[model samples]
Target chain A: MFEQAISAMASVVVDPYLLGLIFATTILGVIIGVLPGLGATTGAALLLPFTLTMDPVHAIAVLATIYVSATFAGSITAILINTPGTSAAAATTFDGYPLAQKGEAGRALGIAVISSTVGGIFSVLILCFAAPLLARVAYEFRSPEYFALTVFGLSMLASISAGGAVKNLIGGIFGVWLSTIGAERVTGIERFMFGNYELYEGLHFVPIFIGLFAISELLVQSKTVDKIIKTVSMKAVKLPTLEDYKKIWKTILRSCGIGTFIGVLPAEGATVASMIGYSEARRWSKNKKEFGKGSIEGIAGAEAANNAATGGAMVPTMVLGIPGSGTTAIILVGLMVHGLRPGVYLFTEQVEKVYQIFGSMFVANVMFMLMGLYAAKLFARVSLVPTQILWPIVFALSVIGAYAFQGQLLDVWLALIFGVIGFFARRHGFSVAPIAVGLILGEMVETNLQHSLKMFDGAWWMILTQPLALMFLVFAFLGLCGPVIFSWITKQKD
Target chain B: MKNIYLVPLILSIFSLAVIAIALQLDTSPEMIVGDSMQARSFPIFLMILKLILIGILTFQFYKNNPKPVALEKYHTWGSMFLFLLFYLLTVYTDMFIGIFVVIFLMSILWGERRVWVAFLTATITPGLVFLLFDYVLKIRFPRGMLMNLYYG
Candidate 1:
């Protein structure tokens, strides 16, 4: 394992073509991240179809690098414009903007860039070591265990801060039902095709993903297209001074740990990680009063955690075929698009590919750090692009992306329809994440359940006989009800 | 329409309809010999589960009594309609035309009052898209009536 990993890293490091692609995509990721309303998920979705013709490892590398670099780029806008480029950077605005407001924009950006690099590097290291081990454990899992794991993944969606728990679950179930629209794999019987030839393969994931994340977001942006953003001027990004690093190194390190853990959990992503990191930094800070008032530690904490989450979120996504966040869910779709199925075979047979991802992420972290430290001003100018102008281009790209995936005009219509459904769903307070997750995991859940029943002679209850499967089911139950149970416990104590 | 319970109510009705449809699926006995779970079985199970969850959701929404959602701006609906038009234009006319028209019209609708700016955006965006996707990637888009006429 060690030799293979080293070999993969060496190959990636020496490949100028791959490195240049990484550099270009990292810059693209930064621009996407620096533009509010174009988060990493949307970026990944829009770029996914374009990557289809490329080699699988290179495609995954491109997508993974984008995910890594975009998380950090969001903080640039958060600091300069008081508008988070992505939801992941929302927490950064609390102190990042105020720091810029105090005319320390360079100093704040320095701390953010360094902290993000460290956190991202730490999480990449974790992903490098942790993913294989987790996949090995998953290798022992059977159909029943896989079914429980997917359910646990869906259950985790309930706790996503997008909306009420019940609403998230509803969205997830609705997505699962949507996944069932095509022909059933087992009997080759069409379930919900309604006699359409395109429905034979079911609703394509790429168009649906693009529609749900990008087009729906475009509609949302249309509501506020007339709004203007004012950017803070910064001469150049400065690395934090030695004294400044002394004050917040621990905070950055702690947030890296926190961010990675939260990111590894299903459904929770960089946004939640950053919020928790900020609050935890406050909880542990020697100068809590400085928080939300341009504290360097505050910037370090949020920036580190959110960037760290980019790597952390890839863990379950590659190991268990379960997405750790909305962005990773889209990346999961990208992975499948490239014919790389996540799970045991990927780790054992395609282990080198996994290490290539780690190498790409590491390079992305270093590349973005250099760009953030030097050319942040250029990227920050991206925020000045008017929403009216930017969104139309994005819509065009989204149209191309949807249509290009299978070269199907019907897919574009499907995207528009889903976009409308997604828009109203969000308007009515539903989070689109669950729907995406459910759609991704729906086939896995149904296939596994069918396999499990076959093995047990159609006695569904026999699944409980398997210890590992039972344990996962228990975890799924806890995942769905743990918060409520814990809240009740607190109430009883009170 | 903004009532929080309305979503669950609609979902419940949809689930019932799906269950009704699922139950009527033709499943041969041979396919169900080894496993009772057949093609329709999973969706039916899902719909049933969804109905139960919707029951919980409706109860939860009623108990929570959340504030009504605000109506979307006209621009939001306008964009959707514009996209629909873009799709039709692409289907009937050309992808390039659809791209040009949507960008131009969407920019206007999105409050870009300067016709030049909208036109510039409209022209430049498709040019870049064609350069990258069509020229570099070599992925040829389907020709529509305008392309056919020009070629003819």
Candidate 2:
């Protein structure tokens, strides 16, 4: 495996075309992430269709670079504009913008880029080692185990709800229902095609992701096109000195751990990770009150944690075929679209690509670190482009992106319709992530459950006897009920 | 906020209808090995799960009086109308032309002050898209009457 990984790394380095694709995606990712309302997920979605034209390894390399760089670029707007370009960067704005206000914008951005790179590299190493070990165990899993795993994945959505668990479950199960539209694989029976031959293969996930992530945000942003947000000018990021790193290395390291662990947990994303990191940094700092007022440690903690999450999120997504967060979910779609099935098969049969993915992420981290140092102002300026102009271009891209893949006009309509529905769904307090999670895992769950039932002669209770499956189910149960129980415990204390 | 439950209520009814359809599906096919868990099994179960979830959500919403949301100052009506109009035009007409028109109109509607900005965006954006997706990537886009006339 080590040899294979080395070969993969070497291949990626020597191939100039793949390197160029990675660079393009890295650049595109910075621009996408510098704009508010477009996160790594949106970056992944907007670029997904273009991947259809490339090699699978290059496709994922593009996606991985985009994923990593976009997460880093989000901090640019957060520090300079006082508006987080991505949800993960929201925590950065607390101290990041404050530091800019104190005229240490260059220093704050410097710490951010440094911490982001460190955290990113730290998580990529974790992903490289941990994912293979986890995938090895996953290779032993059977139908019941898969069903249980899918259950665990789906149940994570319960905690993802900002509205309520019930609402998230509703969103999730409805997404599964949406997935039932295609023809049944075994029986060849048309389920919910509704007379359109296009619907026979199920809703093409790329367009759905694009529409949900990009177009919905576009509609929301369109309403406020006239309002302009103020932004501070930034010239360049001051590189962190060795003494500076020596002072805050502990916080950066701890936040990387915090970010990676949080990211590995299904549905818990960088936003939560960064917040937790900030809190922990505050708790452990010698100067506690200095946290929210342009503390370098604070920016380091948040940036490190959020950037580390990119790698942490990919572990579960690549190893389990289940996303740890929304951005990873979009990347999973890209993987599947490129004819790669994530999970055990990925680790076993397509292990080289997994290494290439890690290699790509590593290269992206280094590339962004360099880019942020030299071109910090360029990305920050991208944030100041008028939303009306930027969004229209994004909208045009959405049309082309949806149309480019599969050459189907039907997909364009699907994207258009879902864009509206997604806007309404967001307004109605439904979590879109759960829906996407359910949609992605729906087939896997159904197929596994069917296989398990066949294996057990319809005795569903036998799943209780399988140790791994039972353990997973118990964990899923705990995951779902933990939030409510915790809230109740806190409420009782209150 | 008064009628916020309308969406949930409609969703609940829709769930019931889906369940009804799921129940009517064929259990097994002729080519199955050893009578496998058939077509309708998982669908029925999933729909039932969804129904139960929707039921609980609807009841919870009914019990807790939802707070009145202060609507945003800018209503999305004009923007939404423009979106739908552009979507339809792009769907029926050629993609390139559709993109051009939508960008031009949306730029103007969304307060891109300079007409030159609109013209430049409309003309240049589609050209980039065509050059990239069509010329470089080899994905063929729909040639609407505009492109057809030009080519002819």
Candidate 3:
């Protein structure tokens, strides 16, 4: 594994094409993240089709690099404009804007960039070491275990949904039902096709993602195209001095660990991780009063955790075919598009590919960190682009991206339909993340359940014989219903 | 008419329709000889769950009877008409032309009166995007009535 990883690193260094693509994508990602109203998920979704023309190594590298840098770039806007470019950067705004208010925007940005890079690199290292070992353990899993795993993945809908649990779960189940359209894979029966030929092959993931994440957002943004307030002139991005580093080094390191841990959990990605990390940093700091008022530690903690969560999110995505976050869900689709199946077999059969991913992530980390360090002032201007021009371009890209996958007009139409649905769903306070989760894991759930039933001759009690499956089933149940149960108990006590 | 209650009402109807359709799916005995859960089982289960959720939402909305959702400065029908018009044009015309016309018209209609900026934006942005696919990346896009003749 080490030899393969080393070789992959060497290959990345030698291949100027890949390095250049990584560099360009890193910059693009920063710009995307720096822009308010465009998050990592949308950024990744837009660039997804662009990666189709490239080699798999370069493709994954570009996307992964974009994912990492974009998460960090959000902090720039969060600091400068008091509007978080991404949801994960929302916490950064607490102290970040204040630091800018105090004329220390440069210092705050420097700390944010460094902390984000460190956190990202730290999580990548964890993904490097942990995914392979976890893959080995995952090799032991079969039908029953796999079914339970899918359940656990689905149960993550509990945390991801922004509304009432019931509402979110409904959205998730709706998406799963939608995935059941077209001919049944195992049964060969035309199930949900309303006689449309397009329904014969089921809903394509990429176009749906494009419509839901990008187009829907455009529609919503169109309704509320207000004036952007680019009032503050961004100061130079100053590199943190040795004293600055010494002050928040421990907090940054802890937040990296915290972010990775949260990220590894299904559906709990950067936003939640950064929130937790920032609070944890405040809780531990001796200077707690300075948390929301120009605290470098606050910026450090949030930036580090959010960026770390990107790498941490990759863990489940690579090892188990379960997406750790919405952005990773898009990355999962990208993986499937590249003809790469992400599971235990992927580890053994495509160890080289896995190593290549780690290598690419490493390069992306270094490149984006350097980019953020030097060119932050230039990139900050990206946030100020008029919504008039931006949404139109996004619409154009969405139309083409939806069409590129199948060369079919049907996909584009389907994207349009989904875009409309997604817009309403968002307006109604229903989260799209749950739908993405459900759509992604629907196939896995169906296949595994079928396999388990077939393996045990319809004996549902066989799950008791498998300890790991039983544990996962228990976890799944608790995960989905835990919040409801907790709320009820609290009410009863009151 | 544009109340918060309409959301749940629409959802319940959609869910009911889905359930009705899912139930009509023919998963006969022979098809499910070995397995327990049929193809329709998951869909039916999901639809029922959705129905229940919609029911809860409907009950709450009616009981509380919240104010109609006020859309701020929204031209709802206009935007919807534009979306439908633009997407329909995409299928009939060249992809590039469709995009340029849609964005330019939509932006102008919504706001942004700058002619050169809007014109350049509408042309350059969509042109570059689809051109990457049609030319650089070698992905196919509709040439429409205009571009194919020029190429030929």
Q: Which has the greatest DockQ?
A: 1
| Model 1 misplacement above 4 A | B30-33, B149-152
**Per candidate, chain B TM-score?**
0.88, 0.77, 0.81
Report residue B52 deviation for candidate 2 (angstroms).
3.3
RMSDs, each prediction?
1.6, 2.2, 2.1
Residue-level lDDT of model 2, residues B11-129, one tens digit each, is 86787787788777666644573435767667778777877777777787788878645464343556567667776676577667777888888888788789999989999988988
Name the regions of candidate 2 deviating beyond 4 angstroms: A161-163, A489-494, B27-38, B55-64, B70-75, B150-152
Q: Write the per-residue lDDT of candidate 3 for residues A1-494, one digit (tens) a residue.
A: 78886797678877888888888889899999987777899988888888888877778888888889899999999998898989999999999999998888889899998999999999999998989899989999998998898889877776762666666777788778778888887776677788987778788898888888887887777765765585466659899999988889999999999999989997779998999999999999999999899999999999999999999999999899999998999998888889889988888888888788888888888888898889988888888888877887888888788888888888888788888888778877788888887898888888788788888888978975899999998998899778789999999999
| Candidate number achieving the greatest lDDT relative to the actual structure | 1
The sequence of per-residue lDDT tens digits that candidate 2 reaches over residues A1-494 is: 89998898778788788778778788888888898988888888888888888888888888889888988999999999888988889889989999998888998999999999999999999999999999989989999999998888888788772557888887778777778788887777888776788898888888888888888888878666667787776656898888878868999999999999989987667877888888888889998888889888899999999999889999999998989888899889888888888988898898888898888888889989989888989888888888768888988888789988888878887887888878878777886778888888888888888788789977888988999999989999988787778899999999
Could you tell me which 10 consecutive residues in candidate 2 chain A have the lowest summed lDDT? A159-168
Error of 1 at A178 (Å): 1.4
Instruction: Please give the ranking of all candidate structures by TM-score, highest first, separated by commas.
Output: 1, 3, 2
What's the TM-score of every candidate structure? 0.97, 0.95, 0.95
Model 3 chain A, poorest ten-residue lDDT window? A226-235
**What DockQ does every candidate get?**
0.70, 0.59, 0.58
